[model samples]
Target: MPSNSGRRRAGADRSPEPRRKPFWRRALRAIFVWGFALALLGAIFLGSAVYMTARELPTFADLKSSQNGQMIVVRARDGTELVSLGPSYGRWMPYGQIPQVMKDAMVSVEDRRFRQHFGVDPIGMVRSVMVRVETGRWKQGGSTITQQLARTIFLNNNRTFGRKVREGVLALALESKFSKDQILELYLNKVYFGGGAYGIDAASRKFFGHPAAGLSTPEAAIIAGLVKAPSNYSPTADVKAAIARGEVVLGVMAENGVIDPSEAAAIDLSTVKIAKEGNQNSVRYFTDWALPQLDLLLPETSEPLEVWTTLDVGMQQTATSAVKANVPGGAQGALVSMDRDGAVLAMVGGTDYVNSNYNRATNAVRQPGSAWKLFVYLAALEAGYKPDDKVHDEPVTIEGWSPHNSGGTFAGEIDVRSAFAYSKNTVAASLGNEVGFGTVAAMARRFGITTPITTVPSMVLGTSDVRLIDMTRAFAAVSAGGTSIEPYGIVKVETTGGKLLYQHRSTRGQVLVPPHVAAGITDLLQSAVAIGTGRAAQIGRPVAGKTGTTTSNKDGWFLGFSSGITTGVWMGRDDAKAVPGLQGGRAPAQAFAAFMRYAVKNRPVEKFDTELKLPEWQLEPDDEYMMGNPDDYYYVDENGNMIEPGTADGAARTGPASGPPRYEDGSEGPGTAGAPPPAASEDFLDRATGRGNQPDPGLRAAPRPGTAGPASGQRPPTVTRPPTVTRGQAAPVASRPSAAAGAPN
Candidate 1:
């Protein structure tokens, strides 16, 4: 409001007196701003210098494509390649060769400023900082393609200011070192797509089974979105979220003018491409077990290598489905399958490998129970007892220790066929004693029983321990006719360039049983499936198997074989706790049944062994072999003829209609011996009557062989004529036990 004249005077007066904010003040501000800018620029330059140099550090392999430019072909046993893995070069092209749709998709999803920035966008950093500042926390990165490439090829895993600075410097260096096109090409080719895949090419092939260059609009968008966070965009690991991310990326590409708005709108984001196959076909257990066995030959320690194994992808699928169907829910189990020569064809450790770490097939060692009877009976057969031979069901004791049948009862008397077919515990126990605990133990060892065994009489009852892998291999020995072989997983390893570096094949050795004997045993095991405890395992084709259930029903196991494959299954609680009333004939046998059902479904059905037969036996009881009080019945006779009618101390040896033989001639015959004269010694009578170790009054001669076994699924009880028995002594039975209701028939 004062006048212009006054204002002019005031201005003139001020101008002349002061340059108060003189040279020093102005100079300070200029220096401060320029100094800060120079320092920032300098820091970036120093970091870029350090990072670009890091690329030449030979550190590329760490994050580079595994198999490093190589492709691994997983082949089935029959030489069928199941999968081919490598870069998807055809489906994926450099950023230049990509369709505008793909470019837009990538630009929209990753960094809209990708085209304008000098390898990075400071704007992105500032925005990221703003976001973090608003949230009062830092949770994001502002990495550009160049920065990612530098990190991929050189940097260790660290998230810090120094690392980011280095990243920017390296990005700029890379831009200087290579053309933008080349840098983009490498970046597209080097990004990881989660699931052990690297580069768009590999990822495309892994996800789509095609080259990346051929990617469709939606596919391109999805893959482009993955560039932002490959794992986050993984459809295999998570599909809904991945698809949502792709849509957002397409929008960005349209906004950035990388693609036409209409094209961006047409890009599909409703669904994502899914993996054609799971990495291991869901048979994690078998694969894991096979992994260690691979070291047997490849020795990963010797050199970096791969081994080509004989796994059949189809068979693996079969095994996985079978496990899920057969093994009880909330229950865990393991299955191991192998070829006759011990080449592991398929293995599955548990129902859901992603959720379970327990490997019931190999890691868990549970009792095989009646399954152990196979070994017991085999030992008997090896000891010269025929499958049809007779064995006493009378009470027997080994060092005052009595072994009871699984159901805690005796069959009174039976032949080996009845004993095995019915899974009678008493006869098995008797055969175990006769075969000698050493014999059964030896047989198990030859078949690769890794667990230690005690020579307790119970060993005759299959009390030893074994793993599923070893059990399958041992059972395979039976199928292969006595050739013991090792199981292996890896088959051959080659460089991505096709240079063979390692290979593995099974090694075989002749074990204890003869081929014929093994074949014979297999024949009986087939009966076990067809007419015995393993009835559930009787597949459409010929199968031989044995089922075992542990005491208290804690564990269940089944071992069986077809012409081409042998498998073992174990079911139990992880903590070694009882599973209530679970038994071998339940879960394990069922799993075996389920596995064979599919394993043989699409494959050729073959007979177990074309050349095996059950042999006949003739029984003759051995009195000396009686389990208790060996001297209660036999003594020297006056005539030294060992007469049945003779007695000790000049008294006649006899019982009331117990046996009726007072032969003047030494000819042999069978039946209830006609009661002989009473033995002179009432002491023998007292011993017989006291505990009545004497044969049960209910004991009687059984019908002859041809008359008995054919009636029931079981063999006849045996009653054999003893060798010149005086009053009390009988010789060991010959060949096999006789079939009879109460005697060797």
Candidate 2:
């Protein structure tokens, strides 16, 4: 019985393994449950995002009717429209009216699968992400055309996960609501194409000066390329860049079969006729200067505004022409003109607007050269020295810095007026030392010089860099009879509907210099043009000015003014290299004269003294180091010989009254002076002023023994000595130079 029971137990144990379940079936069941849960979660998250985004989405009607807010239409004071800014739009055309080539180019370059995608292109997004990850840079973007339109019309460009999610959701919503052509039309209408163009129609008009229907393949390609980086690829900014980008777009079109390779190749970028808006190109600098003011007045706009600027079209043209006329080939020039009230009438930032748009007149920082001496002289006047007061014009050493004249020639002693007129470096440095460099700099800053001025002796010679517009404004302060002039362009701004938003009245400000002090400066500057380095700028209507030539002729300038206006001209290589023989008296002065002649033609002739009377002041005694009277500095003969001072006419009158011999070296010595000065020089100085009695050229005339220098048949020099003085108080007469005394001024 025991053996039978054991056998039964063994049988029961062996029979138990019969009905076990398979391992693979349980594993498959577990995977199915997890997969279903994950799919449900993803669907729920996507639905929630879409529902949230949809709640904020606008209807098609709202999208179509939306506006980008008010634009600014800048007009000259004369009511001539200079430019229109702020989402400049063209006539919106239906999608059917757009050229097939343009549509193809846009789709190929911006979104290749535009017609196939529902909202966002999955392939494009993955490719963009992969590229970014592989290259560690966002070299390409993935937004489909619809998504771009959605972001542009309804969202900001912020790079955030929420914004991106919103963009994607909105793109999908738009796709569901509109047809592909409708979506493409909206995209083309809302996208920015640079140069104040928004939408394909506007871009076509802005770049090609025509409607979208008239767009050629190349032109369409150019506009299509601008979607990548509008400002960088704008045809107006860099035509070559725009063309290069267009080539890329054309390549894409050819690859996508939108256009045949031969057709794309046949499209020449040069054949694209870019329409030039005269007003926008001409006063581009004025617009740039006015935009900041526009922002300040209407930082956030809801409607288009009409801004009246102080630009005078005639003056603007004159400024552009003058710069082009005088700036040497391969050199850059800038000119700025402002009325006595500091209304900026004209600004020429570069030689040619097409070549460059850099507003050098307002933005470039260069050494003012002797033009900075105005501050030094003004400071001296403030420090109890009159224009007639004498100063030693010998070499000066200040803290181991010795300053000499351009040619190392020193005029022993000269009056303040003569020193300034002659632009004597030694005298300016010495005088700046006598007063303080801080005093000179403070005086300069008082007149609207924004550039940093170091408290060094050399600063007196304008070693500090300064903006041409600022310098012009500084002179404008003097021209305005001591009233501080805030150089401004925008005079009034209002809604296009004529609702007043902001208005700039010609308000007079606190006088920086006393009327009398400014008059003194005015007189000195007048004498500068009458008998100084700035003689080339004489405009016959009692102008006052200064000439500036930096070391090695790296920069040349003429800052000058009449009672009605102040103008500054700067000429130099963009690289700051010296131009052969460039000087303040040559190109810059001539440019200033040419610009002023045209700028003030309609204005009446006015005198500084009429506006500001001279203040009653006593003359101070000259320093012991000084040796002559204010009017006794120098008088030259036709032979370029310095005649000893003591003549009935105030100065020795030995030179012929006509065209005196022109000297190559700017000094009063014999050096190839028999020939007439370069026709360029003579014509430059004489043509604009219309005065027969222009001051002698900065260079002296060579003498013909007993016969006066060659005659050109002009009026005698009208500029006379300040006043006659006694022997000790008499201005030092220029002595005949001994051999080996020739030097360049």
Candidate 3:
């Protein structure tokens, strides 16, 4: 073989002679492969960037101002606004208003390396990775202060891969354009503290009732800790938890030299002081009025906007004070006061708006017990019945039921005026039966008592449920001479800078009885205040109203109206549990009295004009039109016996009370002289004692359809003569008359 150099030269010559491939061709092939791979990666990156940046852009307001927000003042009058601040300012605060110490604490706790590495802290990422490796768990995060700031200001609002990449990019861009301080300031001012607070300033004020700059070291630490979780570690919630979190923050601050160990230890950890029950909002009750107004004013899905209510702060305070003082202990209370035009002036839904959102004035629906009688009386008046109309006060039964007075004793006889002032259940029920339940329900709707009026005999006795505001407005209608106007809270909704976004125009109309008829009812209602169930609500002012107390005392309500103010009050438990021994004449009446005493203290006391002052309730001969016992109100036509409408009621046809029959068996019976009623129902032994297959009328087969005989008679069941064989009750069914003939109880 040749030498190495000689062999290479000979090999080169031989290869060239054999038509060697072109150098550019191989280079082009390699370049093409590299370009293809790089292009593929570039496309992937471009697609990712485009997708991330293309997320739907939010409107200017949608992100910054959407909230279930309303402005309200519990008290207001004449067009003047008292508690003016409502939903506005993006977060209810400005950046300059924030405290420096709070900002410092946040910086120390959230991102200590905020000053270094642009937006994304490189050191933090490295440290987190190291910790994760050392701890064998992913317990740390790589997000920098700038990333969090971007999330607060504007970001994907999501936790997806695309959002994360975009967040990273935005953070880097922000750091490039803005200083670390600017981003940090923005974060501090824009973050939410949850309970309706958007920034540190608002959070501090809402929790401590003071500016954030006023916070002490421990307070600042607690606030800083709240940055991670507001509602959870709120000092107002769990004091121990808040202190524990504050201590953790103090440790961090000490570790970072933000504070010395001695200084940290000196910090007081005496928890944040809130209202104890709930957030202290000035326009609490006005919220009840404004919310409905907003729904009507705003479009179904309009841009975010704030609703400024026309609530007077002083009035609201007075109303709350009144409720607090007059409401029975262990009983929840609510009050509503409005101006002549139905503008809400003062309201206290409950003891605290923050702890409970029940909104008794607006949302609570309790039985209007006797107050419901107002509508029935109004119906009767509208149907040509007079206040002096003679009504019966004797035992009478409906289809199968009968009503009794509150004291379980008849008044012997009385007129509509006397019956109304006393809130007689039997009298009110009689009025309902006469006017018809449907008519009463319809009339109630006109006065803003829009809830359904159930169909039942006792329903006429005010067994219907109605809200405080609704009842208040209904009574307000009576005060306004039957002009029904819907209650309103917001006079107009405006922007933070005073731009009028919406202006409400509320008008009153007539939905039921004429104004004159309403006047008659008003006369009696005023009498109730003078001397009746509503005596507690008497303000020495000429006013008209009704007092309501439900069975078992579940609710107490007083709806009354004066010349300048129309108010309603309710007292009960949040759980709807019956308040032992509480009635409308007590707590609710007292609450109404207190509110009216303060609210109308400076107003004039005016007298109302009564349509009819005649005492036409003179003793009249028996007639069918009389209220209670038809026989007492009606008589025969002349000839031995004859009648038209009188016969329609079988009770009136029954002859004079027949003395107990002279039994051939000489056995005693019920209703006999000096003897009590047959012990059939009272004595369980009569039912339990086995008297050898004696036919227990209760056990007798129920009536078959269409046939009418003593056996299986076509009559309904009842309380006094309930089927003993069935369950729950025992009575001598054999001697009991048909339930359809009359009410058992």
Candidate 4:
């Protein structure tokens, strides 16, 4: 028994205590377990984020289509680019067409390890985090080129952890789908540059006036620098800052071994020639007006568009120059010019588009003043009234409102032609009442006045507000041989790939008025410009127009046409405050003339299709009259006493007398009996038309007895009046008058 127990004990002791594991092995096993659990948890998080982001990701087709972006190039009639709406994008350059230097510059500046990373760069992320922690701010971005492309296509600009996870997952997906070169190309073409430019080609053209294929080292560096902060590094925004950023990019390129260090040091970014930026012309008014019409003309699509407009670049420049030169100081002006067929040739919405972009020519509504008389007269003519028909210019009471002439005194019975030519308020009021307010309103609407008319007696005085474009269109109807026209700027719209989207088909010569009625209206407009208030608008051609001045001189307007071109001019304070001596016949008429002079320089002179026969008495008047200015006229009363101009009594006596005044030689003259004709030196028409070299010296003659004139040693009153035909020279008389005859009109 003793022996058996000893052997068992020995066997038990020899059973070799089970080998104990080493500390390093156990530690390694513990690490493997923890690492596996951690990796599983990270996979779950990444998978959940990918699912959430992928649910809203755009399809591959959408991504491919968005590569070119959206752009609208607006070109003038002659193929000159007026403006480009939306972001400017050049033709897409394929990856192979992109220069190797451009690729190096972008890789060096944006993501140096672009080629090495699959999608997310762990080394770059760690380095960026370290830099941020050390600097207490985020200065470097950890996104690889693929990550940036993924974010641009499928993610919003967000800095949250969730967004970062989504961006990383999407980057991986994109990398799996596309090659490195494809990712780089997409990234370069989709990034924004400053000044409304997008894509490397656009940025290259916008900055260096060249394509990405032709980029030099410095130019490439500058464009590549914009990826960091487009606005801050834009050459147009800050050339010095952009150049400094480019220099930094060059340094990065040198460090990456993309370029020789000596060459990088030798490159001078200052020597880079930036393309001249497009002029920010006031033609924006035309483009703005034409853009809204595009939606109505074409189907909705994402393709880039080319809008061929009816704008004439030369005429636009001329219109702009004329408006700028004639617009009064501290006041604003707008001008619009168009063909008889309604093709808009030029438009100037404001004196300076940089200072103010409010389009007065197309948007602003104001009193048309006497220019509104066009509709009134048209209605009258339609009512079977002839230009030679007589209309009383005496004061008339309508609905407790006593309408008086602008001159305050009423001219006695006169032909409708004379009544309109003088712009007699009483005459217009009487005609409005005679023709019926409804008829006048209907007439205005027929001619394209879209604004609501009050139908009150004062409506004839242009008391209603109306847009300048509408009024201009109405007059265009007259110039189109009485045809209705819709004013338009866009002629055709198509894609850059030659796909036709929209094309304007002219509807000109749609007769809106009877030939006789249009002829009568043209006769009146001709008379107004030839011998009436609108004489300042005459350009030594067969031109017709009307002048308009609102109450208190708040708005001035001139609408005229010649050689199939109709133009309208407006001048006033934006606040509707009265400007001292502002009148439609002054600045507005002058601007109209200045613009028309150049507009019709090459066009052949044309006459009205029909002529109105007038009475011999109306054509050859016996009275002699002298107008100091468009606003002032001197007349000798029956008692041989001179009447002061602008007074109510003086305005009443403005027109020709019923009979000729006898002279000392028993020959009839324009003035009272025995009063000689005004001195030939008093060329009021020349001075008003700006044909004379020097400014008017003022009234030089002494005042007649019982009438007051500028006192001795005092500055003479400057005389300004519409052009007048010599007495008995077969004067042309028609219709519409100027109330503020003291003004240049």
Model 2: per-residue Cα lDDT over 1-745, one tens digit each: 5798898888888845577668898888889999899999988987776777666667766766676645878899899988777787787767888888888989999999998888989999999999999999998899999989988887888999999988898888787768898888878887988877888888888788778888878888999999999999998878889999999999999999988999889888976777885455658877887788666776576787888989997778767776876687888999888887888889888877766778898899999888888888877655545454456666556666777664554554445665666667777776676667898888888888888889976788888999998999888888887788888888888887888888787787778865546766887787666655665676557788888888888898888887588899999998999887677877787778777766666678886672211111111111101112222222233332333435526555454322122232233333234321221233433532223543223222223244454244433222122222222442322222222222111
- 3 or 4, greater by TM-score: 3
Give residue 460's error in model 2 in angstroms.
Answer: 1.1
The candidate maximizing TM-score is: 2
Cα lDDT, all candidates: 0.61, 0.72, 0.63, 0.74
User: 79-183 in candidate 1: lDDT tens per residue?
Assistant: 665554443333335467655565556556666676778787899889889989999887556777778878876675597789887777777777665666666
CA RMSD of each candidate after superposition:
18.7, 13.6, 16.9, 17.0
Off by over 4 Å in 4: 1-68, 83-86, 89-195, 199-277, 508-510, 612-745
Model 2: which residue pairs collide?
Answer: 70-303, 70-304, 629-730, 629-731, 632-731, 638-703, 639-702, 639-703, 659-712
**Can you give the TM-score per candidate against the true fold?**
0.53, 0.77, 0.62, 0.60
Residue 504 local lDDT, model 2: 84
Residue-pair clash count for candidate 4:
20
When summed lDDT is taken over every stretch of 10 residues in candidate 1, the lowest stretch is: 621-630
Worst 10 residues of 4 by lDDT: 617-626
Distance (Å) between predicted and true CA of 101, model 2? Answer: 2.6
Candidate 3: TM-score?
0.62
Per-model clash counts, in order, read: 58, 9, 15, 20
How does candidate 2 score on lDDT?
Answer: 0.72
